[model samples]
Target: MPPDPADDREAGTVFLPKFDDRGLLTAIAVDAKNSEILMVAFMNEDALAATRASGAAHFWSRSRQSLWKKGETSGNILRVREILVDCDQDALILRCDPAGPACHTGARSCFYRRLEGEALVRVKT
Candidate 1:
């Protein structure tokens, strides 16, 4: 039998997320003003809760195996304006206002490269 609707959807209007095997949900950040995709990351329960509490973007670093606050090192903080979860609740889209570049490469977004035929091209600002 399938799970109850409450377990899958309605749930009395409360938000319920379906995390992956790693207890992480995919998070996509976009620029609130321009709708430009900023970056993609993962959020564990702790990271999600922290982001909700602080109104800032928090992520689980698979490389560091730790919780990370966006812009902790570079001061390019992402202030979350809104968050929308996927229908199945396994992923989230965060609309945010960024203080500076979102990419570690000093680009406005991590998606600064585009595929041109078979070659990767850097998008000119």
Candidate 2:
């Protein structure tokens, strides 16, 4: 699919859609070649631009209000292979070559949380 049209490039950064300053990124996902969801992230247009320019997983940290390149400090950077947008242009599928574990805790994936009964269970064992 074609890259997002609103995805403008300037000053070495990317810009994505922000609806009425909602600050909620509506499009994003990470996947491997085999279609496993390696990770997911919310992207501001800037994050999308940075990701496109750098070929790394860059995300807009809503809590931190900054750009965070995945595995930047942890040495787990994802080499983005391609960016896919779903129909309606509101969602994204990122194809990447993960350098190492995707999760910050050193797990292969971020889906470490599981459901046990009604409580959220962390899979550490």
Per TM-score, the best of the predicted structures is 1
lDDT of 2 by residue, 56-96 (tens): 87888878989899988989988888887654344677888
Overall lDDT per candidate, in order of appearance: 0.93, 0.72
**What's the lDDT for candidate 1?**
0.93
The TM-score values for the models, in the order shown, are 0.91, 0.73
| Candidate 2 lDDT for residue 106 | 85
lDDT of 1 by residue, 31-125 (tens): 99989999999999999999999999999999999999999999999999999888778899999999999999999999999899999999975
Give me the overall lDDT of model 2.
0.72
Q: Candidate 1 — which pairs collide?
A: none
Pick the lDDT winner: 1
